[model samples]
Target chain A: MKKESQFTPFVEKTHFWGSIFSVLAIIVLVSVPVSIMFYLNVRPEISDVLKGFWGVALIFWPTALIEICFYTPMMGAGATYLSFVSGNIANLKLPCALNAKNIVKPKKGTDEEEVVNTIAVATSAIVCTVVIAAGVLLLSPILPKITAEGSVFGPAFNQVIPALFGALLGGYLVQYWKLSILPIAAATLIVILAPTIGTGALIPICVILSIVGALLMYNNGLLTGGVKPENPLKGLVKKDK
Target chain B: MDFKESKFMYLIAFIVIAFVIGQSLFFLIRAYNHGKKIGLSAKKMKDAITASALFTIAPAVSILATVVVLASSLGTVLPWIRLTVVGNLQYEVTAAQNAMEAFAGSGKAVAFGQDITDPTVFSAVAWVMTLGVILSLVLCPLLLKKIQKKVGKVKLDSGSDNKFGDIITAATFIGLISAFVGTSLAGKASTIEENGVKQATGMGAGVMSLAVLLTSIILVVILQTLCKKFKWDKFEPFVMPISMFAGMGMAMLVYAVLPESISMLEWRPAV
Candidate 1:
C-alpha cells in the first residue's frame, strides 16, 4: 500500500481546489455558447458542431495532451491547473514561471518552487485578462490604423513570437551553452526544412532531442571536466552491515 | 437578433471574463499565502508578482492584436472571450474557421473574416472552439497528479550527486526555446488570403522579424549583464519588458528605414 503522507497537506489541498476550479471553468465555458443560442433563438445542428469540433480536436487535442505531459513536471500542481485553464502556456505562462524560478533559484520539487510557479502563473493570468479587457474597449479607434496597409503595428505584432523567444533564448544560451548547442542546431535545421510542423509539435521533439544530447555528453566525459572516471560504486550496493 | 457585438454578447463575455479573473485571484491568494508559510521572502513574492505582471503586458497587447483581427468577422465579444479564456489566437482562429466551414450546410467553403450573419454559424464556431479544447481541461484534473508523481520520482532517483534533475530541466527549456529560435531565424514566409486581404505571415515579414529578434537578444543580454554588475536587484524585473518593447520599436524602425523589398513586403486588401 502506498503511504498516505507521500504528499504534503498543501499539495493535497491544491489538488482538491485545482480539480474543482478546472471542472467549474469547463462548465462555465461550455455554457457561454449554449446561452448564446438560447438568447438568439438559433440552434446549431449537432452534426455541424461535431464536424467543426472533430476537425480541430484532431489537431489541438493531441498537441494539448503533449503540452500537459511536457509542462506539468516543471509547473507544480496549482500552476498546471490554473495555466491550462487560463491558456497561453508556451507564450506567456511558461516563460513567466521559468523567469521567476531562475531568478528565485528555488530548489526543484520543493514547496517554495511550487509556490513561485503558482504565483507567477496566476499573476500572469490576471494581468493578461485585465489587459485584454482594457484593449477590447480601447481598440476600436486604433483598429484601422493597426490593420491598415503599411501599418507598423501589424508587422511588429507579427514579430512578437520571435522577439519574445529570442530574449528568452539569449539568457538560456548564456547559462547552458553546452546543453543549448544540439537542440538549437537540430531544431533550426528541422524547422528550416519543414516550417509547417508547427511550434506545438516541435516542442516535445526538441525536448527529447535535448535530453538525449545531454545524456550523450555526460556519458562521453564531455560533462565531467575531461575525466571519464569508472563507476566507483559498481557492485558495492549489496554491502549491508 | 443582433449577435455580433450585441449588449447581450458583451454581458456574456463580461461574465465569463469575470469568472476567469476570479479563478486567477483564487489561485493567486492561495499561492501567496502558501509562499508565506513556506518561508519565501516577501521580496521574492513581490518580485514574482510584479515581474509576471510586467512581462505579461506586451504579449497581452499582441494577443489584443489577434482579437482585433478576429473581431471584424466574429464580433468583438466572441474573440474577446475566446482570447481571454483557454483559447489562443492560432487555435481559436483555426477552430472557428473549421467550424464555420463545417456548419456551412451548403458545402460552400467558409473563410474567416466573413461577417457571421447566421446565429447558427456563430454558435457552431463557439461550440467547436469550446469543445475542441475540452479534453485539455479534463486531462489536467485527471492526470496531473500522476504526471507530477512520475516527475517527482525522476527527481528523487537523481539524488544529491547526479545533476539529472537540473540537466533535464534546462534541456527541456532549451529545446523549447531553440525550436522558436530556429523558426524565427529561418524566416519562413507565406501568404494567405482572408476576407480578400493578402496577409504576409511567418518571419517572411522580411528581415524585420529577424532584426527584432536579434535586437531583443542583444538588449536582454546587455540588461542582464548590467543588472548583475550594478547590483540592480530592484530593477531586475524590468529587463524582459524593456527588451520586448525595444524589440518592437526596432521592428518599426526597421520598417521605416528599409524599403519594401528588403524590409517587410507591402501587403494590402485584395480588390
Candidate 2:
C-alpha cells in the first residue's frame, strides 16, 4: 500500500475548513437580504428579482465558474476559499501569493508553497478589509477628494492593476524569458485584433498557449538543463561610474 | 425608507466586514501554525505577511474609489458591503444597472449612475448583486477538492524526468500576466457617450496605462538590480509596493504633463 503523503491530512483539514467558511459566508451574506425582506417589509417582485438577476447572472456565473477552475490550482485550498469569498483574486490575492512564492522560491506542491500562499492571501485580505473599513468610517471627508473631477488620485487609481502587473512582469519575464515570449506576443496580438475579448476571458486562452509552448520547448530539450539567469539589468550602470 | 445607508444596513455591513476579517485571521493563524509545524522559518512567514500587507495598501485604496463611485447612486453602506466581500466594481455596477432598468420597465429606463430612489428597486439591486457572485461560493466547496486532486496528480512527480507539472503552473501564471499586458496595450481610443457626456476612451487611456506599465517595469528592474548589487536584502520585500506606488505616481504625472488632445487619462466616472 502507498503510504499517505504527510501533507494529505493537512490538505484534507484545509478543505474542511475552506468548505465550512465558504458555506457560512454564503449564509451570512444571504441573510442580509433575507433579513431585509422581513424587517423592512419591502418585498421586491419575484419576477423583478429574477429579471434583474438573469442578465448579470448570464455574465458573472460563467466567469465565476471559469475563475474557480483557473485559480484553484494556482492558489492552494485555503487561499482559494478565502479569495473566492473575499473576492479580488486576480488583481490582488493571486499576485500577492505568487510574489511571495517567487521570492521564497518554493517548490511546486510543497508544504512551504502552500503555507506561503495562504499567509500572503490572508494578510492581503486582512489589510484590504481594514483599509476599506477605514475608508467607510472616513468616507465623509475622503469621498469628495476621490470623486472630484481631475483629482490627483483619479488617474493613479485608474491604473493601479496595470501598474502592479507591470512591476510583476519585469521579474517573471526575465526569469522565464524562454517560456514568456510566445505567450506574450500571441496574447498581445489577439488582444489587438479582437479587442473585445476582455482580459478575464483571455487568461485561460493564454495559459493554454504558454503551456503548449513550454511543452513543445521542453520536449525539444530547450527548457531543461539551463540555469535560471541572473538579473540582465545588473550591468546597466556602475555605482562608481 | 432610506435603506441604502440606514442604521440596519450599516449594522449588516459591520457584521459582514467583521466576518470577512475573522475569516482572514483564521486562515492566517492556521497557515502560520502549519508553517511552523512543517519547519518553515518564522522570518519567512513574517516577511510574507508584512510584504502582503504593504502591497495591499494602494490597491485597497483603488477599491475605495469604486465604493465612492457606487455610493453616488446606490448609497455608501451597500457599496461598502459589496466591495469588501465577493463583489467588484464592474460586476456590482452592471448588476445594479440591470436591476434598476428592470424596475423602471419602459417608463424611462433608470441607469446605474442616477440615484436609485425606489426602495424596491434598491432591494432588487442588492439581491442581484449578491446573487451574481454566489455561484463561486456554492461551486467551490463541491469542485475545489476534485480540481486540486487533478492538479496534485500532475504535480506529484515520482522521481521522473518529466517536470511538466511545475512547468504547467508557471505557464499558467505567465499566460495570465501576458493577457493583462496585452489588454493594457491593445484597444483604440474613441469617443463614447457617458451620462449624455461625450468622452474619448480606449486610445489615450491605453497610452496612459502603457506609460504606467513602463514606469513600474523600469522601477522594479532598477530596484531589483540595486538590491542584488548592494545586498540590500532587507529592502527586498518592499520592492513591489514601492514600484506600484511609483507607477501610480507616474500616472498622475502623465495626466498632468501631457497635452489634453493626446492625454486621454481623464477622470473617468466609475459608472
Candidate 3:
C-alpha cells in the first residue's frame, strides 16, 4: 500500500529531478574537454594508456587507499553503523508514556505499527558537519593566504552559513527528539560570541553541542516523537521477551 | 620521493588497514548475532558474514591499488614531462618543452577541466582519472556481492527509490560552491599581500576544507540515514557522486595547502 508520496525526497520526486539536473551538469562539464580533444584530434600514446590502467589497478589495495577520501567519510560511515546498532537495542524500543496517544492510537484497518520518519536532512547535516570540520583542520596551516584578504566580503557571508544551518536545524528539531536545541543553540552562540576560540575550537564545540543536544532531546522524550510510525524497522521487534 | 615514503601515503596505509580489519570484526560479530536473532538459515548467515567482510575490505583494496599504480607510474612518467638527454653525466637539456609544454604553456587556467586536446603529461593524468572511474565501476559490483554475503540479510540498497538523487545534487552543489569560494579567497589573500595588509579572518579555504570534511562525514552518516529517513537504501548511486565530490574537495584542499611562495599573506611595514 505504499504510495508514490513516500517514494521521493523533500517535496515531490525531487530526487528524480535533482538527479536529472546533476547528470546535465556533469554532461556540460565533461563535454567541454571532450569537444576540444575531439577537435584537436590527438590520440593517446600506448605508454600513456598503460599508465592510466596502472593507477586504477592500484586502488584495489585497501592498505593504501582509505585516507584519500579524507578522514570524515570513515567516521561518518561508522556513525551510521552505530545508529543501526542503536536501533536494534531492546531498551531503545520501549514505548514512552508521554506520547501514548501517538504511540497507541491507530485507525481502523490501518497498520498498528508506530513508524517514525527518519529525517534525511538532519542526519546529512550531522555527517557533513563532522567531515567538513576535520577537513578545515587539516588545511589550517595553509589557509592564511586565502582567508586574509578574503575576509573583506567575508564580513557578509560569515553570517550566511550559520544562519542557514541554524534554520535547517530548526526545521528538524522535535520536542521528543532530544534537547538538541541546547547543543545547537550552544554551537550558534559559541560561533557568534566566542570568536576568540577560533576555527579549531568550533569542531569540538559542535561535537559537544550535538551530543548534548541529542541527550537533551532524549531526556525530554523528543526521541519518542521523532519516531514516525512509518520508519521501516519500527516496532518489528518486541523487547520484553 | 616515493609515495610509500610520503607522510600522506603512510597515513593512508595505516587507515586502510585499520578500517578493513576493524569494521570486519565488528560487523562479523553483528552478523552472527543478527543471524541468531532472526532465525535465518545458516547458509544465509555464513553468506552475510562474508558479505560484510568484503564490504569492509573491498574499497580499501580498490583505493590502495588505484593510488599505488598512479603514484608509481607517475613517478616514472613525470621525467618524460621534462626530458633531458644527459650526455656523459653532465645534466644538459636536449629538448626544452614538448606537447606537455604546449598544454601547460597554453596559459588558460581552467583547472576544473584541463586541456586534453594536446596529449601530454596532463592528458596522461586525465587518462588515469578516466581509468580509475572505470576500474571502480567494474570492480565494485563483485565486491558488493561478496559483502552482501557477509551481511546476511542486510543490503546497501533497500530496493526503493528515495531522495538519493537530491542528496547527490546537494552534495555536488556543496562541493562546487566551496571550491569557488576557496578560489576567490585565495585571490583576495593574494590581494592582501599586495596591499600590504593583514588581519585575522573567521573563514577561508581552511573553513571550506573544514566544511567539505564535515560535509563528507555528514554525507556518510546521513546517506544511510537518508535511506532510512526516506526509506531508500540504494547507496551506490549516492556513493559514486559523493566519492567524486570528495575527490574534488580533496584536490581543492591540496591547492589550498600550497606554500605562500607569492608572499601573499605576509605582513609588511608601511613605508
Candidate 4:
C-alpha cells in the first residue's frame, strides 16, 4: 500500500477544527442578540421576525446557496469556512484569494493551491478585523469628514467596489478575451433591458450562460484548441498530459 | 437605560473582534507551516502574505466607511461587530429597515436613527440582522465538506482534469465580474421632481461611476505594462490598490468640477 501523504492529514485536521470553531463562533454570535433581548425583557413577535426575515431571505438565501456551490471549488475547504464566517466573499475574500493564486501560479486542484488560498484568506480576515476595529476606535474624529453628504470622500467611497473590480476584471479579460465577450455582452444587455433583475439573480444566470457558451465555442473549434468535444467534464479529471 | 452607545456594547464588540482575530491567526499559522512542509519557498509565502495585506487596506477602508454608515442607525458597537463579522452593509441596512417596518406595521416609514428609540424595536432589528445571515454559517459547517466532495467527484469522473476545472472557475469569475460591470453601468434616466421642477438625477451618477471604472482600468493597463517592462515582480501586488486609489481620486475631481444642477453626488439631509 502506498503511504498517505502528510498534507492530506493536515487538511483533514484543519477541516475538523474549522468546523468546530465555526460552530462555536455561530453560537456566540447568535447569543449576543438573544441575550440582549433576554436582559431587556423584550421579545419580538414571531410574526414580525418571520416577516422581516422573509423580506431579506427571499433574495439572500438563494444567493448564499449558489455562492457556496460556485465559490467553494475555487477557494478550497479551509478558506471557504473562514471566508463564509468572515463575510464579504465577493468584495473582499474572493478577490484576495484570486490575487494570491494569480501571483503564485499554483496548479489547479492541488494541495499547494489550497495552502496559498488559506493563507491569503486568513491574512485578509485579520487585516479586515484590525482595520474595522481601528476605525471604530477613531470614529468620533473621522466620522464627520468621511460621511459628509456630497463630499468628495463620500463619492470616492461609494465607487470603491466598481473601481476595484474594474481593474481586477481587466486582467482576466486579457487572458480569456475570447471566452469573456459573451458573458460581458449578455450581462450588459440583461441589465440594460431589464432593470428589475437584481444582482442576486443576475449572477447565477450569467454563470450558467457563460459556461454553456464556452463549452459550445470549445466544441466548435472556436477556442484555441481546435474542435475536440470529447468531453469538457473529462478535462477536469485528467492532469496536464 | 437609554439606547445610547454604551460601555457594555463596546465590551461585546471587543470580545467578538478578539475571537475573529484569534481564528484568523490560527489558520494563518497552520497554512504557513503547511507551505513550508511542502517545500514551498519562504519567499513565496511571505510575498503572498504581504501582497494580500496590501490589497486588503483599500477595501478595508471602504468597509470602514460601511461601519460609519451603519453606525448612524445601528449604534457604534453593534455595527462595529456586525461589519467585522458575517454582515455586509447592504444586507444589514435592509434587514434593519425591514424589521423597523415590520414593527411599525404597514404604510409607515420609520426612520432608523430617529424613531428607533424603542428597545423592543432595536432588539427586533438585531434579531433580524443576526438571523438573516445565520444560514450561511450553519450551512457552511454542515455542507462544505459534502460540497467539496461533489466538486471533486465531478473532476474525477470527468477525465479531462484541469481543462474543465479551469473553465468552471474562469466562467464563474467572468460571470461575477460581468454582472457587477453591467449593474454599475445600468442607471435609470427618469426625472425626479424637486420644488415642482423635474430634474434628471440618476444618469449623472451612473456616468460618473463609469468614468471611475474606466480610469481604474486604464491605470491597471499602464501598471501591467510597467511591471512587464521593468521586470518589477515586486510591484505586481500593489497594482489593484494603486489603480483603485487613482480611480477614486479621479472621482473626487469629477465630483468637484461638476455643476450643482448635474452633480453626481447628491446631498442628503444631515442626520
Candidate 5:
C-alpha cells in the first residue's frame, strides 16, 4: 500500500471547511436583505426586483462565472473560498496572493504554494475588512477630506487601479516575456479596434487567448524550463536561499 | 425607519461586518496552522502576513472612496455593508440606478438619496445588488473543488508538472494585465464642454492615466533592479505599494500641468 502524503489530509480538511464556510457566507449574505425586509414590514415587488436584477445580471452574471472559473486555479482551495466571499478579487486579494507567492518562490502545483496563497489572501481580507470598518466608523470626519474635489490626493486616488496594474504588468513582463506577446497584442487590438466589448468581457477573452497562445508556444518548443530561461530579470535578483 | 442613514441600519452593517471578519479570521488561522504543520518556516509565514496586510492598505482606502460615493445615495449603512462584502462601486451603482429606473418605468435618469424615500425602492435596490453577485458565491461552494481537481489533473496528465502549470498561471496573469493596460492606453479622444470651455477630454485623460501607469512600471523596474543588485530581499514586499504611490504622485503632478477642462480627478455626482 502506498503511504499518503502528510499534506493530503490537510488539503482535505481545508476543502471541508471551505465548503462549510462558503455555505455559511451565502446564508448570511442572503439573509441580510431578507431579514431587513421582514423587520421593516416591507417587501419589494418581485417584478421590480427581477427587472433591477436583470439590468445588472445581464452583464455581471456571466462575468462572475468567468471570474470564478478563471481565478480558482490560480488562487487554490482555501484562498478561493475566502476571496470569493470577501470579494475584491482582482483589485485586492489576487494581487496580494500573487505577490506573496512570488516572494516565497514556492513550486507551482504544490502544497507549499497553496498554503502561502491562503495565508496571503486571508491576511488581505482581514486587513481590508478592518480598514473599511474603521473608515465607516469615522466616516463623518474622514469622508470629506478623502472625497474632496480638487484635493491633491484626488488624482492619486483616481490613478490607483492603473498604477496597480502597471506595477503588476511590469513584473509579469519581466517573468513571462516569451508568453506575453500574443495576449498583449490581442487585447490591445480588441480595445483599439472593437471598442464595443465591455471591460467585463474583455478580461475573459484575453484570458482565453493567452492560455491558447501559451499552450501553442509551449508545444512549439518556444518555451521551456519552468519560468527560469524566460525570466532574464530573475537572474538580476538574487534569491536568499 | 428612514430610508437614509439610521441607527438600526448601522446595527445591520455591524452584524454583516462581524460575519465578514469572522470568516476572514477562520480562514487565516486554518491556513496558518496548515502551513506550520507542513514545514513552512514561521519567518516566511509572518512575512507573508505582514506583506499582505501592508499591501492591502492603499487599495482599501480606494475602496473606501467607493463606499463614500455609494453612501450619498444608498445610505452609509447599506453601502458600508455592500462594499464590505461581495460588492464593488461599478456593480452597486449600476444596480441601484437600474432598480430606480425600473421603479420609475421610464428610461429617463432617476436620482437617489433624498429622492429614494420610498421603502419599496430601497428594498428593490438592496435585493438587486445582493442578487446580482450571488452567482459567484453560489458557484464557488459547489464548483471550486471540481475546478481545482481538474486543474490538478491537467498538470499531472501533461507530464510537465510545474512547467505547464507555470505557463498557465503566467498566461492568465498576463492576459488580465493586457486588458487593463490596453484599456488605459486606447481610450478614445473626445471633446467635452466644461465650465463653458470646449476642450479635448477622453484621450487626454487617458494619456494622464498612461503616464501614471508608466511611472509605476518605471519605479518598480528601478527598485527591482536595485533590490537585485544589493540583494535587499527584505524590501521586496514594499515594492508594490512604493511603486503604486510613486505613480499616483506623478499623476497629481501631471494633472497640475494640464488644463482645468481636463479633470484628472474622478468626480461622483452629488445626490
Candidate 6:
C-alpha cells in the first residue's frame, strides 16, 4: 500500500463538500417554515406551540445534523471495528477452538482496513436521512396535510417515546448487570444535580461523568462489566484517523 | 367516527401485515445460514419464529406504554374549552377603518375546560402525519428494494434452492402478518366527540398503538438497511431515538403543508 493510502475519503475535499450540501439543506429546511409563520398572521396561541416546537427542533436539527453527519457515522464505524478487536482480545487467553484449525488469520490491519469501508457507507446513509427527515421536521409546520385531519400529527408526544426507551434500557441494565447500580446512581445524582448546572444540561453531564468513570476504571485495569458511562460516545470517537 | 376518526388506520394495517410476512423471509435466510450449526429442525424453526414474533411485541408494548403516558398528559393539558357569550356589544375583531365599532359588554361567562391553551386538532392530525409519511416514505421503499434485491438475486442463481425459496417467501409473509395484527387493533379503536370536545374512545391505547406500529415498521426499515451494511444480525436498541426524531420531523412536515380546509377539521372551542 502507498504511504498516502492511509488517508481516508472523509478528510478529502469531495466528502467535505457533500457534507456541506447536507448542512445547507438542513439550514434552509429549519428556517423556511418559521419564516412562513411570520408571513402568515397565525394565531398567537396556536402559533406559540407550533413555533415553540419548531424553535427547539430547529436548533436541535442542525446540531444533531453535524453530530450524525460528521460525528456518529465515523464513531459507529470505529466503535464496531473496536468491538471486533476487543472481542478477539477478550477471547485470546482462552483455548479457542478456531485457532486450532491454523487457518489464514487476519492481519492487524483488518480493523483499520475495514474502517474506511464502514465509514463511507455509514456517512452516506446519515447524509441521506438528515436531508429527508430535516426537510420533513423543519418544513412540516409550514406545509399542509394530505389526509382528513387537514394537517399532520402532533410531535410533542413523539418525545415521550425516547424517554420510554431510556426507562426500558434502565430496566434491562438493572436486571442483567449488577454493576448497573453504579451508573444508575451516577445518573440519578447527575439528574438531580443537573438543574443546578442549568436546564438542558443533563445529557452533557451524564456523558462526561460516564466517560471519566470508564477511563478511571480502565486505567485501574478492572474492566469486565461493560457498564461504563461513556459507552455510547466512546463508540463515537473515530480516532482510527 | 366523527372528529376522532382514525386517519392513518390503513397504514397501520399495512405495516402489521408487512411484519408477519417479513418474518418468513427472515427465517428462511436464517435457517439457510445457521440451521446447520444451530441444529436445524422444523419444530425448532417454528419455535424460533414464534419467539421472534412475540419478542417484537415487547418493544411494541413499551411503545404503547409511552403512548398512554403521553395521551393522558395531553388529555390533562388539552380538554374541552367552554365559553358562554351571553351579551356582547359591538367590537371590531379586525381594523376595517383603523378602528371600527366600540360598544358596551353586559354578561359573558367564558368557561374553559382544560383544553383552553390548545383548542385545535393539531395534536391528532400531527400523529396522522407522523404515521403516514414513515409508511409512505420509509417502509414502502425499503421493503420494495429489499425484496427486489433479495428475491431478484435469487432468481438469477443457477436455480432456486428449497432454502432460498423458503427464506424469501417466509420473510415477506411474516412482515405482512405483523401489519395485519397492528391494523386490526387500531381499527377497533373508537372515536367520539360531543359539543366541540373530540377524543378517541381509548385514547391512550389508540395513540400508543399508532406509535408502536410506526416504530416497528421503522425498526424493520433500519434493520433492513443496517443489516445489509453492517451485518450485525440483530435488531438495535437505539432504533427508537432515531425513529422518534425522524418520525417527529415527518409529522411536522405533513401538518405544515396541509391545506387550510383540511386543517380546519381540528377540534376547537365553540365559544
Give fnat for candidates 1, 2 and onward, in order: 0.77, 0.75, 0.03, 0.66, 0.73, 0.02
**What does candidate 1's lDDT look like per residue over B1-271, in tens digits?**
5568789899888888888889989988988898898889989899889888888888888788778777767888888898888988567767777787685556544667778787778877888888988888899889998888877765654555446557767888888888777767663654445765665443452477678888988888888889899999988877777787788888888878887777764222112
Clashes of 3: 65
Which DockQ value does candidate 5 get? 0.46
Per-residue lDDT over B1-271 for candidate 4, one digit per residue giving the tens place of the 0 to 100 score: 5553767677778888888888888999999998899888888888888878877877888777766655666677777778878877456666766676675544333555444556666777788888888888888878888887777666666635456567667887788777777766663433323323454422322656787888887888788778878999888877777887888787777878887445464222111
Q: Rank the candidates by lDDT, best first.
A: 1, 2, 5, 4, 3, 6
DockQ per candidate: 0.65, 0.42, 0.05, 0.58, 0.46, 0.02
The TM-score of predicted model 5 comes to 0.87
Alpha carbon lDDT of each predicted model: 0.80, 0.79, 0.28, 0.75, 0.76, 0.27
Tens-digit per-residue lDDT, B1-271, candidate 2:
5667788988899999999999999989998998999888898888888889988988888788778767767888888888888876556666766777676654545565677776767777788888888999999899999998877764543214335556667788988888887767664333433354554432323668888888888888888888889998778888888888898899788879998545554222222
Docking class of predicted structure 1 = medium
The segments of candidate 2 whose C-alpha lies over 4 angstroms from its true place after superposition are A1-7, A147-149, A225-241, B106-109, B157-159, B162-165, B188-205, B265-271
Q: Give the per-residue lDDT digits (tens) of candidate 3, residues B1-271.
A: 4431335423432332233234324433443443354454444333322322222121212212212222222331222111100000000010111122222333521121122222344444433333332322222222322332332122123223122222222232222222222222221121111112343222332334334434443454455355557865334223323432443344344335654342122222111
TM-score of model number 1? 0.93
Query: Tens digit of lDDT per residue, candidate 3, span A1-241?
Result: 8654322122122223323333332333233224324533555565644544454345322311221122112122222222221110000111110011122222211111111111111122222222222323353233333223343322222222222222122222222123333443454355334433322234334444454444344334455455422332222233213
lDDT of 3 at A88: 9
Q: Considering the two chains of model 5, state its CAPRI-style docking category.
A: acceptable
The digit string of per-residue lDDT tens for model 5 on A1-241 reads: 9865333676777888888887887887888788668766797789878988898899899989888888888888888888888888887888889878877777777778889999999899889988888887876567658655467777787677778888887777666878778887888788677654656788888888998888777766678753333332233244322
Best by TM-score: 1
| Range of the 10 consecutive residues with the lowest summed lDDT in candidate 3 chain B | B83-92
Top candidate when judged by lDDT against the true structure? 1
- The chain B TM-scores of all candidates, as shown, are 0.90, 0.88, 0.24, 0.83, 0.84, 0.26
> Taking the tens digit of each residue's C-alpha lDDT, what string does model 5 give over B56-128?
8878888888777666667777877888888864566667666766766543324643345666667778888
Model 5: lDDT equals 0.76
**Can you tell me the CAPRI class of model 4?**
medium
The segments of candidate 6 whose C-alpha lies over 4 angstroms from its true place after superposition are A1-52, A55-182, A195-208, A223-241, B6-56, B66-271
Candidate 1: stretches off by over 4 Å: A147-149, A229-241, B104-109, B187-193, B196-206, B265-271
